[model samples]
Structure formats: structure tokens, C-alpha cells
Target: MDTLNCIECFVRSAEAGSFAAAARRLGLTPAAVGKNVARLEAGLQVRLFQRSTRSLSLTEAGEHFLREAGGGLDILQVAMANLASRQGQPAGVLKVSMGVAFGRLYILPLLKEFLARYPDVQPDWRFDNRPVDLIAEGYDAAIGGGFELPPGVVARALAPAHRVLLASPNYLAARGVPQKPEDLSGHDGILIRSPQTGRIRSAMLRSGDGRETPLDLRARILLDDPEAACDVALMDFGIILVAMPHALPYLADGRLIRVLPDWYVDTGVISIHFAAQKQLPQKTRLFIDFVVEQFRLQGLDRRFSAR
Candidate 1:
């Protein structure tokens, strides 16, 4: 057995969490994948996986080896891809994850031009509003706000993930505008409850001159998703705190207005993340570069938090 081939099998199986899933990815039978991993274990004289009928997990040795060897294997794949890319056509299935709202409002529109330029590329994009484990899930890249960068991952910031108070003009006229963060307490607040904990997230609102005010959001309508809360806010229900990008269109066209525009909650930066390795597939690399360039052209990359 080729030692590198066995290493590939070991890393893929570890990431996929099942020999069967790795087999599908590697275009091998599940038994062949199992045998390859077994050969690797035999060669190393160590058990790499704790396996059962229902679950598969990495052994302590496996975890340690993956940290060291996974990058080498990925680099090998990148080298191979680089050789193929020398022909000047980047072709492969590009897998990406992004936020639902941002993807729909922003990235989805750019696909036509992206695909037209890289006609050989096939894009598989997932739009959801949750954290993703890049390696474990086998994603090529992800675009969202403030995902933790585990080892083997890096990020390029796209924009400030600033949250602003938004309400429909009708709602503001009806309830009166909040002159300060404290006034939000007197007004109805459409709040975002955490999906994991169901707790309404409290935030510190910051003013332009560096004043911070703690906001204990009083939820008139508590929801787990930002889109839903924004919808409620649009209906003149209450003031909603949302990502600045989400409120941009509404604020521009007069559907919604920003309250205390000088004050915002600095969540973090919205960024695109990818696996960091010595070498990378041309398809993934080119896609990341292109997205950043497009953001620059569109002025979407502006750091609203700074303003």
C-alpha cells in the first residue's frame, strides 16, 4: 500500500466521521476505505479510530496525528491541483457556506458573473445562520460573521458586523424615536433570542465618542432568527437591532430608519474563512480572491463599525 494513500484515507475518514462517507468522497468502497485505514493503523502500530455500529470517533492518537498530518495531506492535494491548474483552467466542485440573508442579498447576485468567468467551476453553496466546523464538514470555504478560526483555518474580513437599531418610519412616528440607548427601554424592542440557549442577547451600545451603554433588551416579540425579527420590525411592531447590511436597503428607500445612528453595537467583523494550508486548490483560492475584489468594487467591504 502506498503510505501516502493510506494517510489520505486516514485523514478523510477522520474528517468524514465514517469510512462510508470517506469512501464516497474518495470513490472507493467502504470496505476498501476501512482496509486502507486499517493498513495505516498497522503501519503506525496505533489505533486511530474508536468505531462502533452507531458512531465513529478519533482516538487520542488519531487526534494528535490529524493535527500533524492533515495539513501535509491537504498540501499534497493542493500540489496536485496546482499541477492541474497549470493548464490555466480551474475546474472542480467548490463548496461554500454563508449566512442566508447575506447570501441572498449579496453573494447570490454575484454568481452569474463568477460562473461566467470560471465556467469550468461548479459551485455548491449552503446558506444557513449557524457556526460550521470547516474541516469536519468538508467545506471548501465559508462566509459569515465571527466564526471561530480553529487550527488550519484563516479568515479575510469583508465588513463590520455592526448592529444598528431599526424601525419602520410608522413605528418611530407612533412610538417616538429613542434619543439615547436608555430610551430603548421605554420603547418596544423586537429582540433576537439565542437559538442554542433561548436567552435574549444583551449588548453594549457604543457611541461615536467612545461611550458604552449596556442594553438589556426588553423583548416585545422574541425570536431566534434575525430575518424574522426584522420582518416584525418592518410591520411597525417595534424597534429591532440588526446587522447594518440588512438595514441598508430599507433605510435607503425609507421603509426603515436607523435610531441613534451614531450609536451601534459592535458585534465583530463579517469575514470569509477557508482552510489554511501550505498550498491550496486554485479553484478555492481564485474564488476567495474574486469575492474580495467584488466586495471592494461594491463598497460592501467598508467597515461600518469604524464610522
Candidate 2:
């Protein structure tokens, strides 16, 4: 079998966790899938899978190989897409996942323009607050806050972002504004938790004099959605810390007030990430470039400039 075919088979099999599942996805027989994986293992002279009667797991060597090979595949796909764009129209499906609030506020509006420009391309979007495994889920790309990239993926920064402390004007008036980071402990706080990890996001507050204050407050309301948290803050429930972009419009409209402006909080990066695979279809590359350009044009980083 060809090297590209073998590599494709390996990735699919690994992601599916079984030869039968991978074969079903590829429309090939289970035996054919097994043959491809065997050929790939022989070429590399390593045992890639630990096979039991009913399950298959990656060996350590396979894990390492996937990381390196996946990146090469992404590069190859980018190159092919670039060439295809010059020849004709961009075509294929691009599957993307993102956070609910960010997607609804930003990406959804931009989709109209993107589709208008590349009518031949199709987009499949999934919006949720949960973190997804890009390769295992078979997504073409995903947009999210920057973190350490997982194995077998490549990440590109789309924009810079920061966490901001905010509360509604009514809330601040009733409870008083926090003059310092430590003051937050005395105020009612609406905490946002990650559904996938079940962990509350926390950050260190840095004063102008380089003093750092760690905040570990009990939330008056513990919730997972930022939009809901914002609503609670607006209704005078408590103060909330959220991404600056999501809070900017409210801040500008006098619905929300920024607190402790001099303190620096830990920032999150907005980025697009994709699997490292070879011979990427044209649609995915164009979509990524489009997103980056849109963020640039909108000056996404400026949302947190006041901080």
C-alpha cells in the first residue's frame, strides 16, 4: 500500500480504537484496514498497537509517531489547499467546534460573509462549553482559548485576549466596587465552571507595584455558562470575571462596570487549532485563513486595551 494510504489508515484506526470501526468509516473491509496498519508497522519497524481479543491500544512508539506524523499531514494539507485555491474554487466540508458564547457573538455573524465568498464550501459547526478531542471527534478545526496543544495537533493564534473583572452598575452601586483584588473576597462573586473539567477558573491578580493577590472566593452562584453569569451580574447578583471581549459591549453601554482596573489578571488566548495531517482538503485551510483575517480586521485584541 502507498505510504499516504497507510498513514491515513493508522490515524483512522487509532482514533476509532478498532479496525472494524475504522474500516466502516473508510468504506473498506476490516481485513484491509488491518493490512494497511501492519504494513505501516513493518515500515517503521515498531509495534504500533497492543491488540487484545476485543480492543486495540496504541503503543508508546505509536503515540510518538502520531505526534510527528500528524504535523506533517497538516502541512501537506495546507500546501495542497493553497495549490487548489489557485486552480479553481475551494470545495469540501470544514467541521469546527467552539465555545457557545464566543461562537454566537463573533463567528456566527462572520459565517455569512465567509459563505458568500466561498459558496462551494460547506461548514459544520458545533458549539458548546466542553473541550473536545479534535482528532478523535474528526473535526477539521476548532476555535478556543489558547492552552498547551495536544498531541497530533497544531495551533495558531487568532487573537489576544484577557480576563476582566466586571459587575453591573446596579450591583456595584448596591454592594460597592472592589478597590483591590482582595476586596473581591468580601463581595458576592458569580463563578463560571468548566462542565468538561468541573473546575473553577482562577487567576492571580497583580497590582501595579508587582504585588500578587490570589483569589479563592466562594461563588454566590456557581454556573458553567458565561452568558448566564453575565446576566446574574447584571441583575445585581454579584461580580463576575470573564473574557474582555464578551464583556466589552456591556461595559461600553454602561450596563457593566470594570473593577480593579489597575490589576493584571491571567489572560487566555483565542486561537484556531487543527489536526496535523497530510493532503488537507482545500476548504479547511481557507476557513482558517478567513477566521484569522476576520479577527485582524475587527481588532479583536483591542477589546482588552483598557486593562
Total clashes, candidate 1?
Answer: 0
Best by TM-score: 1
Q: Model 1 TM-score?
A: 0.87
What lDDT does model 1 reach?
0.85
Encode model 2's per-residue lDDT on 1-307: one tens digit a residue.
Answer: 2888888788888878999988876678989999999999999899999999989999999988888886676567566656656357786667799998889888999989999989877788999776677876678889887366788788788766567788888878887878777688888889988786778866777666778788755589998888888888888888888877678778878888888888656566778988766555678777888999988889875664435
TM-score of each candidate structure, all chains considered together: 0.87, 0.78
Clashes of 2: 7
User: Candidate 2 at 165: error in angstroms?
Assistant: 1.1
| Candidate 1 lDDT over residue span 1-307, tens digit each | 2898899889988888899988877778999989989999998999999999998899999999999998778888877766766368788889899888889989999999998988888898999888677776778899988446788789998888888888999988988888878888888889887665688777888988899999755678888888888889888999888887777877778888888888888888888899887577989988999999999898886734535
Worst 10 residues of 1 by lDDT: 298-307
